[model samples]
Target: MENGILARRRRELITGAVVLAALAVLPLPIADVYTRNLIIITLLFAGLAQAWNILGGYCGQISLGHALYFGAGAYVATLLFVNAGFPPLIGMFVGGAVGGLLALLVGWPCFRLSGHYYAIATVVVGEIGYLLFLNWDYVGGATGVYVPFKGDSWLALQFKTQKLPYHYVTLAFAAAAWFAAWLIEGSRWGFAWRAVRDDVVAARSLGVRVFASKMAAAAISGFFTGLGGAIFAQYVGYIDPESVLGGQFSILIALPAVLGGVGTLWGPVVGAAVLMPVSELSRSYLGGSGRGFDLMLYGALIVVVALARPQGLVSLLGRRRERARAA
Candidate 1:
């Protein structure tokens, strides 16, 4: 029985690795600017979604405020680079550490609560963070801080005139996040998390330390998001309250995870691959000077998807497959 199970898992791993390798090489013959740009955007959001999944999906701790971590990473890296003359490459680690510490600080209190209480706590945390960054003068107050354009400084994380480098970097992060999720899903920590998620009381009865597990998840989740945020800031060459760190930023991370299928390893990746392109198209067609078209489209889509398939895209597909096999 064990051998059979191991064989099946090995086959699945090989197949997935092959698919990912193909995707990594797909850009070798790239010619279209728009297509390359779209891929980059997809990978960035996908990475964010996977990072959020660590806490929201796997641990059943729904955080609507993950942007707090992302924004912190962006601001820290940009500030260190701009003011302290620290290069962005090294600043990435600093940003991740700050985000992880904040996660532990917040998670300790909030994890004591359950269900909606926990959810609401996340909202409050995000709101306070947004307000604080908006008012802080050292980080540019409400105006924002900008990174000097280094045409080709590898140490500073700037590349000579090309989106390809940024695209690859973002893809690498997305891959790392996915692998991390897989590791967590298979480890003893993952088992404890699932037990606690299903029933905290039962988990506690079985000797699971719920608070410690949640804090661990938060720390890991925040680290990935912060790292992604640092990369995003460098890619954009700017950081502002509204742009890098906002409730909307958190929403973007959560949406893909929810839509794709929370708790599943690859769900966020699939969700982002589907959601972001449609969003970009909506923005291109309808977003402009104060136009609300993209917002309308997104709102409608979320509503329809929620009502029609609350279990998410992955669940819906699985049901169809089961039905077909039954037939």
Candidate 2:
């Protein structure tokens, strides 16, 4: 039995390594902009979702206003770059710090609420940020801010030649976020988060610092989400209130982890991969077929997936693996 377990683990490791290797070089032959852009977008969402998973999935803090942090990262970095000539590559930290700061401000008060109330509070905070930025002309208001394209500078993380560099950069961010999630999933903090997630009252009784756990998770989540925003703004060379700081952005960020398998390391990544393609394809092919047809398709998919597998699509595969081991 021990030998079999070890062999299975080794095989799985090898297979995972092989898949990653293939993906690392996937862009060598592809030259089409659409396909490359799709890959980059998928990776972008994956990183954002994974960051969100730290709080939402692990700590059970269902925030509907996560875009607050994401937009902060983008706007702050862009502002620093445009005004101070700080360069976005360096200002990314400022963006992350701002995100953590916002989380600190909100999580303290909002953590007092439970379930839907907490979620609603987050949405309100996000809306406030959105409206404030929409009116504040310093950051370009509703017109949005654009990163000055001063030729190609690696220090600024600007690449002018092709989308290939972006593909790898986004992949790096996704991979790094995934690795962080993996580490946190197995750490002492991870256990505390899981405890708090399962039952706050019960966890407190067991000497768990419920508030601290949730707050830590939220701060970390915001920090990474903010980093993603910085990368996104820099990559797109644009940032606007409606585009980055909206409720839709929050929904897309949080939904992927839940749809994949909340509390699991790769849940958000899997969810992003599945959700993005479906959404894009639906919007592309079904847009002219009927008004709101793409949204209808997306809704149908979420409902079907939720009803068919409440534990998520990952659970289905997990069960198969369990059966294989049993056999």
Candidate 3:
């Protein structure tokens, strides 16, 4: 069993490396700005979903208020850049730290609840955060913060004419998130989280530190989620309560993971790959009709996917692998 586990880990690492290498070159052939931008959004959400999965999937804590952390990261990084003259490269890390810290703080109280109650608490917390940011004049209030164009510099993560750099940047962020999940999936904490997720009573009886596991998961999830938000703020060159901290943003973050097979390694990446394109295409083509046709189309796709693959699209890959091994 030990050797088998080690082999599986090695294989997963090799597979991840190959996939990253392919993604590195995948965008080079596409010159269309819209297509590249779509890819960037997909990559960003892929990372965010994976980050959420660390807590929601493995730890079985379904949080609906992740936008609080997401917006926190965005606001923190933007504030540092605009007010303190800090490079976003540095500010993003600070934002990630704030996100992780905030997650721990939130989890301290909210973790006392379980199941749907915990999820509801997250939504309430997220709403409170949105309201606070919306009224806080220091964070630019509802007017939002416009990230100034400080010339095209990698240090600042600003690119005026090129979209390829953003693509790679998001890709790297997604890769880092995926890699972190991979590490946790193989670690002692990963097993403990899975135990806690599977059954709290059983996990406790078996000596798992359920509360600590949940808190650790929350911190890690919030950290990457915050990092993703900072990347998004920099990418769009703007940040606002509605844009970053809205209720809808939290749903968007969790949907990919839930639809893609919450507990699996490649679920978020696969879900993001499918979900984001369909969403972008619908918005681009149907949004102009002004009747919410784009939203209808997006919802239809989600319904179909949920109905057809309740175990997530990643299950298809798992099925194929099982078949190959059986043969």
Best by TM-score: 3
Position 305, candidate 3: lDDT: 81
**Backbone clashes under 3 angstroms, per model:** 0, 0, 0
- Alpha-carbon local distance difference test for all models: 0.86, 0.87, 0.94
Q: Write the per-residue lDDT of candidate 2 for residues 79-143, one digit (tens) a residue.
A: 99889989887798789889988998999999999988999999999999999999998889999
Q: Candidate 2 lDDT (Cα, whole model)? A: 0.87
Better of 2 and 3 by lDDT: 3
TM-score of 2: 0.93
Off by over 4 Å in 1: 1-8, 288-290, 320-327
What lDDT score is found at residue 202 in candidate 2? 89
Stretches off by above 4 angstroms in model 3 are: none
Model 3 Cα RMSD, 1 decimal: 1.0
Point to the candidate with the largest lDDT: 3
Where does candidate 2 stray beyond 4 Å?
1-19
Every model: Cα RMSD to truth: 2.1, 2.4, 1.0
Q: List pairs with backbone clashes in candidate 1.
A: none
